[model samples]
Target: MEPLLTAHNNEATSIAQLTAAQQKLYQWDKTIAAKHLYLIENKDTPYERLTTLKKHLAPLDATRQRDLIARYKALQTPPRGRRVEEWLRSWVEITNMCIAADVPETMGSRAQEDFLVACRTINPEYGTSGLRDLIDLEDAGTAIPSVEDYVSKFTTYLKRVLPLSTGLSSMAAELDVSKPQQQNKDGNKNGNKTKPQCPCGLKHY
Candidate 1:
C-alpha cells in the first residue's frame, strides 16, 4: 500500500487544511505505520517490551486506537467467501477506508457495488439472491434512504434469512448422504426424510 501520508501530502496544500475527519484518519494511519516501523527496527525485541512506544507518537484515545487497529487488519485481508456476514463486513471495511481517505463519494459507492457484484458472479445461485433482495427492498420504499441505511437494512435482512438459506441446507444434505439410507417396507430408501421442505418455498431446502 502506498503510504496514506504521502498521498495526502501530494493532494493537499497543507496538513492544517484537512477537515477534522481527514486529520483524525491521517493520525491513525501515521500511528499504525509508526508502530510497525518501530517493531521492524527493534527486530530482536518483543512488542511487550516496547515500553516507550506510545511516547514516540501522537496520543490517541484507547477505544479509537482499538477501532483503527481492527479496521486496519480488515483492510490487510482480501475479502473472501460468498457468506453474507463475511462479505458485508468486507464491503463495509472498503467503504470506511475510502471515507477515511476522503476519496470521492462516487468512487466509494462504485467500489462497494463492484464488490457485491463480484460476490454474485462467483456464486450466482446463492450470492445473486442477496444483491437482488437489496435492490427489491430499496425499490419498495424501504428504510434505505441513504447508502448507510442501505447497508444497515441489507445486513439485517441477510441475518434474518441466513438460517433458511440454501447454503446451510446443502450442508445438511451432504451430512445426510454420508449415513446409511434406511430401507422402507417395499425396499425403497426413505430419502424423503433427508431433505426437509423449506418453509419459505424459496429453494432454500
Candidate 2:
C-alpha cells in the first residue's frame, strides 16, 4: 500500500510540473512555427527572415535589442552545466559571439572587467586568474561599472526587450549541469586522500 501510494503521489507531482512546463513549451513552439509558416506562406527568403527579425527588433531600445539577439542566439547554442563556472562560460561565449557578429556593443569593452569587479566585490578570494584571458580585454583601461551596475542595467534592458517575443518569455530557466566537479581516478568519490587544491584555491573533500 505504501509503495502504491508513493507511486501515485509521484505521478501527481510529475503531472503538475509537466503540465506547466508543457504549456510554456507549447506556446514557444507555436510562436516559432507561426513565424516559419508566415515566411513560407509569403515566399520569403532567408534574407527576408533576417530582415523581418531585425525590423521587429528595431523599435526596441538598443540594450533590449541586444538582449533579444542574445536570446535568439542562445536558442542556437543551448547551455550545458550545473556550476556558476558553466554559466559564466556560456555567458562569455554568447557575449563574445555577439561582439564578433557585430550585433551591438551594449556591454562595451569593460564587460569582463565589470564582472571581475563584481566578483571581487562579492568575495575577495573570488580572485580567479585567467578570467582576463577568457574574455578579450583590448580596452580595459576604460572606467567600466561594477557587476551590480551591469546587472541593474541588464535587467532593465531585458524588461524592455522581453515584450518583443511572440510568446517567448523574456526570461528562461536554464538547467545547470556544467558546474565543475572533482572526481577520483576510478570514478569513485574523492576518498580519504588529500586531493590537490583547484586552481581557484578551493579544496575538495
Candidate 3:
C-alpha cells in the first residue's frame, strides 16, 4: 500500500504489455459493443443473451461489493499500522475493473476464456499506483485530477482479465484443410480410414 499510486510502479514493465489477454478482452468488447448490450437489454433480440451474461456476472460483481464493505468496516476500526482503504481510490477501481472484466470469463466460451485473460497493459506512469503512498497517517490522500489516472488503471485491469482469443480462428483453420469428405459416417470413400467422431461421440460426416 505505498501511497495507493506507487504500490505497483516498481512492477516490471513487461508485465504491462498485452500477450494474449488484451486480444481476448478486445474480442469480447467487440462482441458486447456490436450487440449494443444496453439497447437490447429490454428488447427480445439480445435480451436473453444479455440477461444471461448479467446473471453469470452477478456473483463476481457481488463479491467486489462485499470486499469493499469489508474494507470499509476495517477502516472504521483503523488498523494500528496498515494503509487505510478509504484513501486507495485507484486500488479500489483497479480491483473492481478486474472483476468487471471477469464477467465474460466465467461463461465457458473460448473467446471469453482467452480474451484479455491477463491485464498486462497497465503502465505505471498513467496508472493509479503512482497516486497512493506507503505512509499511513490520518492525513487526507491526494485527489486524482486527470481522467487518465482512472482510465489507465482500469484499462490495464480490464486487459489483463480480458478473455483469450475467440477460438474461431483455429476452428476455421482446421476446417480449411482439404481432407477428403467422408462419403458417410461409416468411412472415407477410398477406405483409408473411417472419419474421426466428434467430441459428442457422434459422426458429423
Candidate 4:
C-alpha cells in the first residue's frame, strides 16, 4: 500500500494500481456512508443497516484509511477530487445533522411496514440500492439538483408521514382491547351473581 502511495508521486510510473485502489476505497466509503444515512433515515433498520456497513468496511486495511485521508486532503480545495475520506466525512456530517434534528424512530413491525409504504408512496425509487446510490452521488458532489434539494424534499415527506405512522400505531394499541374472560358456569365464585365488566370491557370478580 505504501508502495502504491509513493507510486502517485512518481511521474514515470503509470499509477494505475494506485488509481484502482483509490476507486475501491471510494466505493467502500460511499457504502459506509450510505448505510449510516439509511440507519438515520429508517430507524427501524439501524441494527441491520449498521451491521452491513461494518461488514463492508471491516476488510479495509489501515493503509487504505491513511491513503484515503491523504487523498481527501488533496480534494478539500477547489476542483474537488474524488476521494473516499472526504465523501465519508460528508456522510458523517449529514447523519449528524439528521440526528440533531431529533428524527423519530420507526419502532415495531407494523410501524416499520407503514413507514416503508410511506417512503414508497413519497418516492417510488427509494429502496436500499436507490437510496444508497443517491447518497453516494450526493456525498461525492456529483448529484444533479444538489444534495440539499434532494434532502429538503425527503425531509418534508418524512415529517408529514412519520406523525401519521406513529398515530396509527398508537391507535392500534389502544383499539386492540382484549376480550374479557368468561367464568365457568359450573364453578360460580359468588352464589349466582354475575361479574361486572370494567370500562375496558374486562370482567372482574
Candidate 5:
C-alpha cells in the first residue's frame, strides 16, 4: 500500500495540484503514468481496485518535464575565474532538478561524459582525449587516492591550464621584470643603504 494510493482522495485533488515531492514519490513521469494507468485499468496488480478508483486523477503537466539532454548540451562551462567547486555545485543542482523531473538522461556516465566535454572546451589543446594528459600530470606524485580525487585532480588541472589559457604567464613575466626597476627606485630613495632587516629577522639582500 503505497502512500500514493491511500494518502489522498482523487475526487478532491488533481495531479497538477500535487506538490513536486508528491509527484516524485509516485514516479509520475509521462511514461510511468501510462504504465501505471494501464496496470490500474487492467486490474493487473493486487492493488488494482484501489488504483482504478483513483485513475481519474489528472496527469502531470507535459510542459513541466525538462529535456535534460538539451539542457546539458546548452550548458556552458564556467569561465576560468569561477572555481571548480562552484561549477560542481551547479552540476549537483542540475542533477537534483533532473531527478525531480524524472529525466532519463541523468545517468552518472552521461554526466561524466558531459563534464569531460565541457572541460575540453576550456582547453582545446587538450584535444578531448578524456583529459588523460592533464589527469596523469596531476596524479603523478600522489600515491593515495581519496573520495574527492576527481574534484581535487580536476581543480589542479584547471589551475595549471587557466594561466596558459589566459596569458597569465606572460603577464607574470612582465610583473617580474618591473619588480627590479621598482626596487632600484626604492634603493636610490634610501641613499644606497642596505634595507633594514625584516621584522622576522631576515634581510632581503
Candidate 6:
C-alpha cells in the first residue's frame, strides 16, 4: 500500500498533519492526485501506483523553486556521473506533471513546454517528431504514457541528453537567471551592497 493510505488515521489527522512526502505526492497536482487516488482505491498494480507519484516539483514560486533546485543539486550522492542523469530524469518526470497542464495558472504552461524543449535541445539526436509526440501527450494531460510503450524510449532519450557537469552547470545558470533574487531584511534584493575593491576583482564599492 502507498504511504498515503497509511499516512495517518483519516479522522485523527487533518490535512495539515500529512508528512512532506505525502503532501507532495498527494497535493502537488490535482490531475495526478485524482488518477493516483483512483488507482489506489481500486488496487492497481505497483508500477501504476509508483509512476503516478511525482515528487520534488521545484515549487511554483521563484524563491522556493531556487531553494529546492539548489538544495537538490547540493545534496546529491556520489556527485558525478550518474548524478546528472538522476537529476534530469527527475525534471523530466516533474515537468510531465506541469506539462499535464494540471499546475496552477500561477505556475503557467510555458515553463512546462520550455522544459520539454530544453530536453530536446540537449539531445538533437532524439529527433523532432519523437519529442513532439511527447509534447502532444502532455498537451492532453496524459503525459504519463503507458510504461511498456514509452518508458524505455524515454529513458534512452534522457540518457542521451547531457553530461552531469554540463547539465548541472546549465540548469544552475538557468535557475539563477530565472529565480527571484534573495532579499535581505532591509528589503534589498541580493543584499545589493558594495565593498571597497582593489584590482583584486573584489565587489565594486
Per-model TM-score on C-alpha atoms: 0.32, 0.29, 0.22, 0.20, 0.35, 0.27
Which lDDT values do the candidates have, in the order given?
0.49, 0.43, 0.37, 0.40, 0.49, 0.45
**Model 4 C-alpha lDDT per residue in residues 73-173, reported as the tens digit of each score:** 43223222223223334433443343343323211122223222333433355534445654565578772443334334545543454344332222212
Put the candidates in TM-score order, highest first: 5, 1, 2, 6, 3, 4
Query: Which of 1 and 6 is ahead in lDDT?
Result: 1
lDDT (Cα, 0-100) at 98 in candidate 3: 41
Per residue, candidate 6 scores C-alpha lDDT tens digits across 1-205 of: 2345343336434557666655654443334544345544442444445554432233335555454455433322213332444655555454454334444421444443434444454344453655576678777887444422343464554434323334443432343443458745554466655445788776654
Residue 147 error for model 4, in Å? 0.9
Q: What value does the lDDT take at residue 157 in candidate 4?
A: 49
Model 3: lDDT of residue 178 = 27
| lDDT ranking from best candidate downward | 5, 1, 6, 2, 4, 3
Clashes of each: 0, 8, 32, 0, 0, 0
Number of residue pairs clashing in candidate 6, backbone atoms closer than 3 angstroms, sequence gap of 3 or more or interchain: 0
Q: Per-residue lDDT for 26-124 in model 3, tens only?
A: 334346644444433333333455676777666866687666545433322322222222223433443344445553322222221121122122223
Estimate, for each residue in 9-100, the C-alpha lDDT of model 1 and write its tens digit: 45676678776765665554455554355433432233432444555543544455555545544543334333445555655765665556
Which sections of candidate 1 miss by over 4 Å? 1-86, 102-108, 119-147, 164-205
Model 4 deviation from the true structure expressed as Cα RMSD, one decimal place: 21.6
Position 72, candidate 3: lDDT: 34
**10 residues in a row with least lDDT, candidate 5:** 165-174
Q: What's the lDDT of the predicted structure labeled candidate 4?
A: 0.40
Give candidate 6 regions above 4 Å deviation: 1-83, 92-112, 134-152, 158-205
Superposition TM-score, candidate 2 onto the true structure: 0.29
Off by over 4 Å in 5: 1-62, 67-70, 76-85, 99-101, 125-127, 131-152, 160-205
Lowest summed-lDDT stretch of 10 residues in model 4? Answer: 103-112
Q: Give the runs in model 3 whose Cα sits over 4 Å from its true position.
A: 1-28, 31-45, 81-205
